[model samples]
Target: MFQLSLATVSHGAVASIPLILVAPFALLLLLIATMPLTPPRVKHLWEHYYPHIAIGLGLVVAAYYLWRVEGGGTVIGHTAHEYFSFISLIGALYVVAGGIHIKVKGESTPVVNVAFLAVGAVLANFIGTTGASMVMIRPWIRLNKIRISAFHIVFFIFVVSNVGGALTPIGDPPLFLGYLRGVPFFWLLDHVIGQWIVTLVALLVAFYVFDRRSFARMPVRLRHESEAPDTWRFDGMMNVLFLGVIIAAVFLPDYWFLREIVMLGAAVASYRLTPKDVHLENHFSFGPIKEVAFLFIGIFATMMPALNYLEQHGHEFGFERAPAYYFASGGLSAVLDNAPTYVNFLKLAEVSASTGGGGESTPAAEHAAVHQLLADRPELVIAVSLGAVFFGAMTYIGNGPNFMVKSIAESAGVRVPSFFGYIGRYSLPILLPILAVCGWIFLH
Candidate 1:
C-alpha cells in the first residue's frame, strides 16, 4: 500500500524551487482536456484507470517536493487542511440540498427557463452554487423535459453554476477559500457585485436569444407549451431549516471544531430525516460527491509544490496588470480547479503589492504587503474573483457545480458535451465573447 506521511512534512530553510516540477500538473491538465478526443479504445482504458494515473502522478510530485525542500511538509499540511474544509462543505451541501425536491407544474418555455436560471442565480449566493444546482436542476429538468437540450444545461451551467456564485464566499469554493484565509466573508459582494451583475445580465440576455433561436429550430410539435405555476411545493422542507443551521455555523465565532461537528450532525439529520423515496425521485446518490472527493485529493497534493514555487516567483512572470491577473486566473480555471488557482494568484498579488516600490523588496516590505493589499484591494480582488468564478463554467471539471450539474443532467438523460466539445462549442463561442466584454468593462 502507498502511504503519505503527514508528520514528515516540515518547512525547512527558505529554498528556491525549480520550475520543472510543474510538468506533472500540466500533463494532468492535458490528459483531462484531450483524452476524450482520443480513439474510443484508448479513451476507455485511460478513463477506466484515470484515478490510478492521478494518484501516481500526485505521489511523484509530492516526492519531488519532499526531496527538494523542507517546505514540502508545510505544503502537505496546509493542503490537507484546505482539502478537508473543502470536501466537508461540498459533502454537507450536496447531502442536504439533495433532500430538497422542488415541484412546479410548468411548460419549459424559453421565458420560463430564463426565470428558473435567474432564480438559481439569486439562490446560489446563499445556499451555494452546488446546493442551488441540486435544488433547482431537477425541477428545471422536469419543466423542460419535453424539449430539453444540452444547450439548456449549458446555459444553466453558465448562469447558475458558476457566474451566479460571485456574491458570497459560500457561493463558490474559491471564494470560500479566500474567506478561510482571512478575507472578509462579504468581500466579494462589496468588490465583485458590479462585475457579477454585468456578466450575468449579458449571459442571461445571450441565453434568451440562443434558446429562442434553438427552440425555433426544433419542430413545433416537440416543444412543451405551458405556464409556470403560481405556487410551488417543496418536499423534505425541514431540511431547509437544517440548511440554515449549517450556514449559521459558518458565521459562528470561535468553536471551529464545534462548527465542523455540528455541520456533520446537520448533514446526518438531513440524510435521516429526508425520505428515501424523495432521493430515489431526485436521483440523489453519493456518486458525484464521492468522485469529487477522490479526485480533489490529487489536485490539492500535486498542486502544492507548484503553488509554493509560484508564490516564490510568480510576479517575475510579468503579469502586472489587473486584466492579466484576471485572464491568468480565469484561463487556468477553465481547465483546472479554481480554488488553488485563486489562492496562487492571491498570494502573487499580495507578494507583489508588498514588495518595494520599483526597487529590491526587503523582508519587512514583503511582510507588510498583506496589509497593503487590503487597502486598495478592489482592483486585483475583483479581477481574480470574477475570473475564477466566471471561467469555471467553461468545462465540467472547472468548478464543483459544473460537474454536479452535468452528472445530474446525464442521469436525467441530457447528453452533456465532451470536455473539448464544451469549450469549443459552448464556452468558446458563448462565454468567451461575454468574458471579453466583461474584461473590457471591468478588468481594464
Candidate 2:
C-alpha cells in the first residue's frame, strides 16, 4: 500500500493511469450491453434501478484506483471477506427464526404495528439487521399491500433495516467486526446508550405519527382484514434453535468454522426431522446469503490496496488530527464500505500515537495530538459504528444485504425503491437527520 501512495503522491493523477477511467464506464457499458440479453422482467425491474447496478460496478473501479494508488497487498481484501462471511452466518440465524418480516398492516396505526417493530428491534441485536430485514420486509408488505405508499417501504428501510440494529454486535456488520477485533460483545451497550436511547425514542415517535397517517388513509376492506388478529402467533417455533446456533457462531467466532459445520449438519437434520410444510411454506432459500457471499467476495478482493494505504498514510491527510476526523471517516464510510474505512482510520490513530510516544514527535506536539485523539475515542467509535450501520440505509449497495432485501421483495411482487429514490425518500427524511445529529455530537 505504501508503494502506491508514494507513486500517486509523486507522479500526480496521471501516473500509470488508464484511458477514460474505463472501470466505471466499462461497467456501465457492460450493463447496458447486457440489456438485450436480460430477461424482460429483470430488464424492466432494473432499467429504472440501473443506478444501483452502475454504482456496484463503480465500486469495483474505486477499489481498483485505491489498489493502484495504494500499495497494500491483501489485508483490506481479507477483512472484507471475513466480515461478510461472519455477517452471512448471522443472517442465516435470522432466517431460521422467521424473524425477517415486514410491517405491512397497522402501519397506519401504531397499536397494531408497535409489537412488530419492537420484536424487530430486539431481534436485530440477536440476528443482525440483515437477518431481521429479510424476515420482516415480506410479511410487513404482504400485510399492508392494500395500502401502498412510498413511505411504507421507506419507513421499513429506515427503522427495521438500520436504526433497529444499533444496539448489539450482531445487529450490524460494523459492530460485529468490532467484536471479532476484541471489542467485548457488550461493550457497545455501555458506549452507545445515549445515542441508542435518543435514536430509539426518535424512531418510535416518528413511527407513531406516520403510522397514524397511514391508517387514516387505509382502505376499509384492508382495515377490516388487518383487524382479524392483532394478536401475533408463532409457527415452526423450533426454528429458534437455529437462531441460537447462529448467535453462538457469532459470539464464538474462534470456533466458527467448526460451529458452521456442526450447524449445517444440524440444520439439515432439523429439516428432515420437521414436517415438510415448515420449510416449504416458509419458502426459504439460500438466495439472500449467497448474494451477499458473492458480492462481498468482490469487495474484499478489490479493497486491499486502498485499506492498506489508508492504514499507513491516513494520518498525514490531517483528518483524524481532530474529533472531526472521526465523523469524516465514518461519514465517508456511509458512501464507501465501512470496514476498511474503520480499519484505516483506527490504524492511522494507533500509528500516530505510537510514533508520538517515541522521540520522533516532539513532546509538546505529541501531548497536543494524543489529547485531541483521546477525547475523540468515544465519538470516534460512535461515528464509525453509527455511520456504518445507519448510512448504509442510504442506498441499496451501502451494505451487503440491502440489495438482497430489494431483490427478494421484488421477486415476491413488491416493488422496491430505486437507488436515489430510496435515499431521497427514506434516508434523507428519517435516518439522515438522526445520523447527522450523531455526526454533530461526535464531530463538533
Candidate 3:
C-alpha cells in the first residue's frame, strides 16, 4: 500500500525524463516569487490569471508523464493522493482554527510578544504549524497592532511556522512523513531537543531585539497605553474539540481515504457549528486557503520531475557528512516542498549507507534499510529532518502555512514583505545565520 501511494521512480524511467521537463516548475516558482513584486497592472493580471496559469503549467507536466513515462499512471495517482491529503489536512486545520476567535484587549510589550511567540512555538508541536498559525496569528497581530511591522509577521513564520515544530512528527509535515516511514514518534525529541532549544532561544532573542526597537519607536503616550495588561477571550471554544478530531484523524490509516474523510468531515462540522459572529470577528474567509490550493496544485504537479530527478541522481552528489546533508536538503527545501525533499534525502542516505557496506538497496530491502540507517547513521536522518522543517521558513512557497500566514496578515492590514524581501531582508540576513550556526554546532 505504501509502495502504491509513494511509487518510486523506476531506474528505467530515469533517463527518460528530460531535464527540460523541470522548466515548468522553475517558471512557476519564478512567477510566484516575482509576480507580487511586479507593477500593479501586472500583479493585478497575475491575481486574476494565476490559477489558470498554475493549472495549465501543471497539466503540461501531467501530460508529459502520462504520455512518456512507464508507471506514469501510478506516479500521477500518488501525486493526486498526496495533494488530497495535503489539502485536506491544511483545509481542515484552517476551517477549525477560523472558527475559534481569540480576542485580546490592550497592546503587547516586547516581553509579552516574546512569550506569546514562545507559547506559539510550543503549540505548533501539538496542533501543527498550520493549526497554530491559524489559531494564534489574529491575536498576535492584535497584540502588537499598535506597532506591528513586517518583522512581526516574518519572525512568527520563522519561529512558529517552521523551527518550533522540530520536536515531534506532529509538528512538521516532513517529520510526520518520517514517522510514517517508521521513525519513532519520539526520535526527534530525543535526538534534537538540545539543538531545538538553542535555535529557538537564538530566534527569540533576535525577535526581542526587533520588537523592543519597534516598541520603543512608539510615541510616549502610545507606548504607555500599550503597556496595559492584556486580557483574552476565546469564542467558539467548541472548535477545539473538532481540532482534536482533525489531529487524531491524522493517525488513521490512509486506506480508502479514511484519514482525509475524517479530516474533511471534522472541518465541515466545525464550520457548520460555529457561530457566524465568531467568523466575522476572526475575519475568516476562504480566500487564503483557496490561493494555497490553487498555487500548490501547480507546485505538486510541476515538481514531480524535479523530485524524481533528485530521487534518481541524489546519490551522485557526494554527501558524506551530516552537515552536507543538512545544507543540501535545506537549500532545496527553501524552494521545493519540504516533505518530498525529506523523503528523497532519506532514500539517498539509505543508498549511501548500502554502498558503504551497510546492506542491499533492493525494493524488498528498503524497509530494513530505514532501520539500518537509524541504527548506524542516525545523524544523517537528523540532518534531513532538521533541514526540511527548519529551512521551510526561507520562502513563502517553502511551506504551506507561510503563504497563508502572510495572506492573513495582509488581510488584517499589516504590511508584509514581498517574497524577495522576505528572503533578503529577513531569511538570509537573520534566520539563515541562526540556522547555519545550528547546523554547524550540532549537525556538523
Q: What's each prediction's clash count?
A: 4, 16, 0
What is the lDDT of every predicted structure here?
A: 0.76, 0.57, 0.83
- Model 1 TM-score, 2 decimals: 0.85
Question: Which one wins on TM-score?
Answer: 1
Error of 3 at 251 (Å): 1.6
Question: Which ranges of candidate 1 are over 4 A from the true structure?
Answer: 1-12, 16-19, 32-51, 60-68, 71-74, 213-225, 228-231, 253-256, 356-371, 415-421
**What is candidate 2's lDDT per residue for 1-444, written digit by digit as tens?**
113322232222223334334335434434443553467898787556654665476466556656664332233333544654564555456456442222332433456566667677667787677767766766766656666455666666666777678788778776765655545677677777677667766766777787778877777887776667543445566666766776676554454366556545545545555555655645667665554444444444434334334434555666443346445655655565555455455545644544432122222332344345545554555556666666666766555556666765677677667777777766778777776776576456
Q: Write down the RMSD of all candidates, one decimal each.
A: 4.9, 7.7, 4.6
Instruction: Flag clash pairs in model 3.
Output: none
Q: Is candidate 1 or candidate 3 better by lDDT?
A: 3
Q: Candidate 1: lDDT of 146?
A: 67
Q: Judged by TM-score relative to the true structure, which candidate is superior, 2 or 3?
A: 3
* Candidate 1 local lDDT, 276-371, one digit each (tens): 988887888887787667666777777765655555555577766789889889998988778777877877777565453222223233235534
Model 3 error, position 236 (Å): 1.5
- Could you tell me which 10 consecutive residues in candidate 3 have the lowest summed lDDT? 1-10
Ordered from best to worst TM-score, the candidate numbers read 1, 3, 2
Model 2 lDDT at residue 253:
44
